[model samples]
Target: MRVVQGTRPLVIFDCDGVLVDSEPLSVQVLVDALNRRGVEIDEEEAYARFLGRSLSTLAQILHDDFDHSIDAAFLEDLRHELYDRFRQELKPVPGIAGVLETLDSTICVASSSQPERIRLSLSLTGLLERFEPFIFSASMVENGKPAPDLFLHAARAMKTDPADCIVIEDSPAGIEAAQRAGMAVFAFTGGSHAGAPGYSERIAGLAPDVVFDAMPDLIHLVRQHMEGPDRHRSPRAS
Candidate 1:
């Protein structure tokens, strides 16, 4: 059953690159882990292949492209190392804290990352309490990004019509997922890894409703999109 739209638009955020500047750390950890197994991948290639994807997707890609099978032991070790790196170095995306403090809409996190990782990322960055019980993960849904499942699940859980939600994302997969779910999406390019060659171009190809690199500009963009007209309305709305 479809839910009724709430008076306040629901703002869904992607955790890794959007809320916390953890993409670089995640890529480096993944690359290092793959190198230990003789994969010889670089951070750039890693980002191209794995950014915005879940661990299960990463395992599949490693198996298909490199003929390397990942076992439970390897995944456990990788998580330990990744979490350690995150603990030591992770920081919230620049200006994100300020945006959260001032943005008036109801917000939640819908991420491709596992639930534990999502909580840890937000908790570490001092942003968890703002959206703790509202956090939704790909693990809670059957499909991840580029699929509408996760985003739709979030809308249902939040009791908001998909058409009345806004997704803030930093990856093509995330933007596409939001569009597939019938939500307005804004592409955020302020993460540490945003400068990689061709990254911005790739995101532009997706044609998200808005693309901006400064986090402080986010609240204004959301307000404009909400107030300007009904053009942002989703086709999924009945």
Candidate 2:
């Protein structure tokens, strides 16, 4: 059922590393695809460069950095391979279901991935029903993350002011996007790939409203942020 908006804050979640443990699989597939094309990239490099970014951004990276061209056939093949892995191995982040159940906020997913990929990840992990009709994708906007267009679009679609929304994200780009959208962001680092060297520090450097590594702690953190004396202040407010 769609959440009926109330006085509760809207929580916007990122799909990949925030909701589903698909980053490792996605990075591995992307690296393999690039290797097959003789681009020679690694999973770590891919994670740093492309995590929380749209497919167009990834294609641009390939074009500019590796001098490789991305055509429809290449994208189709890559999508097919990634989807195959997701079906076989994707899992929800630990305790996320409980977090979702425990929260009373109006929640939705706003992600850098395509709409189909987001739905598949949620369905495979049995989380699709929780976010149907509320999923906003970068493909739906003119610009993706790190530009705030997707997050802002999501806020508008949900009929919530950006100041009244909170974004749960697992990437630097995502946190930056939420901040750019003028929404408070909580950095979630519990995903499997979050422990990469300097990754947490990088996320911290972005100065999200909260940084937490356990799903169970989310409700408390969000409540504190939403109910605390500072709740009315924008995350980027001076």
Candidate 3:
């Protein structure tokens, strides 16, 4: 059943840039790995092509699209390297804990990253306790973001109707996926990549329900969405 407007909706957060400040580090590993193998792509290209996308698709691009036959072993190596870097460098997004502490809705993580990767980062950032066991990964389904599969899979797993789930994401692909799944999506534009020169324009083109740059503002925006013009029910205060 759709979560009625007045009721608190299920809140699904994307892990990389939303919950943890790990995108730059994640893409850094990819860029360095590819360059070491003489692929020659820079961080900008990596972020443009792979940020918010799936690792499996990235492997396909390396093999089929770029003619760089990356073996599964290489992918495993990268995964291990990423985990190490995440443990050392990952930080929770600023003020995210406050929002998590106060939100009244059921919360879970639905991400494009591997389940292991998701857990590692969240654990490092001290945010895993809130989302443990309910984590959903794109690999669980056939497709990831921009296909609606992952979000819909998460919705089913969380036992929440698509319409009643509000996805907080940080990528264009994530926003597109939530829309395709018929959920309201709000984009987090406060990450390191969000400061890129053309990011604002790109996000505007996607046209999410709302764009927020600070983690503290998330609570207010979510409350406004839950308590619309008719004022069904105010979001619970912490």
**Each prediction's TM-score versus the true structure:** 0.94, 0.94, 0.92
Q: What does each candidate score in C-alpha RMSD?
A: 3.0, 3.5, 5.1
Clashing pairs in 3: none
lDDT of 3 by residue, 115-154 (tens): 9888888888889899889999999999877788898898
Q: Alpha carbon lDDT of residue 16, candidate 2?
A: 96
Candidate lDDT scores, in order, read 0.87, 0.87, 0.84
| Backbone collisions counted per model | 0, 0, 0
Lowest lDDT 10-residue stretch of candidate 1? 1-10
lDDT of 2 by residue, 1-238 (tens): 1222335889999999989999999999989988998888887788889889999888888889889998898889999999999989999999999999899789999999999999999999999999999999999999888888998899999988888888999999899989988888899999999977778888989988889889889888876766566444443532
Q: What's the residue-level lDDT of 77 in candidate 1?
A: 92
Tell me how far the alpha carbon of residue 168 in candidate 1 is from the true structure, in angstroms, after superposition. Answer: 0.3
Give the per-residue lDDT digits (tens) of candidate 1, residues 1-238.
1223334688999999999999999998888988999997898888888889877778888999999998998889989999999999999998888999999889999999999999999999999998979999988888788788899999899988888888999988888888888889899999999987779888999899899999999888887776665654554322
Candidate achieving higher TM-score, 2 or 3: 2
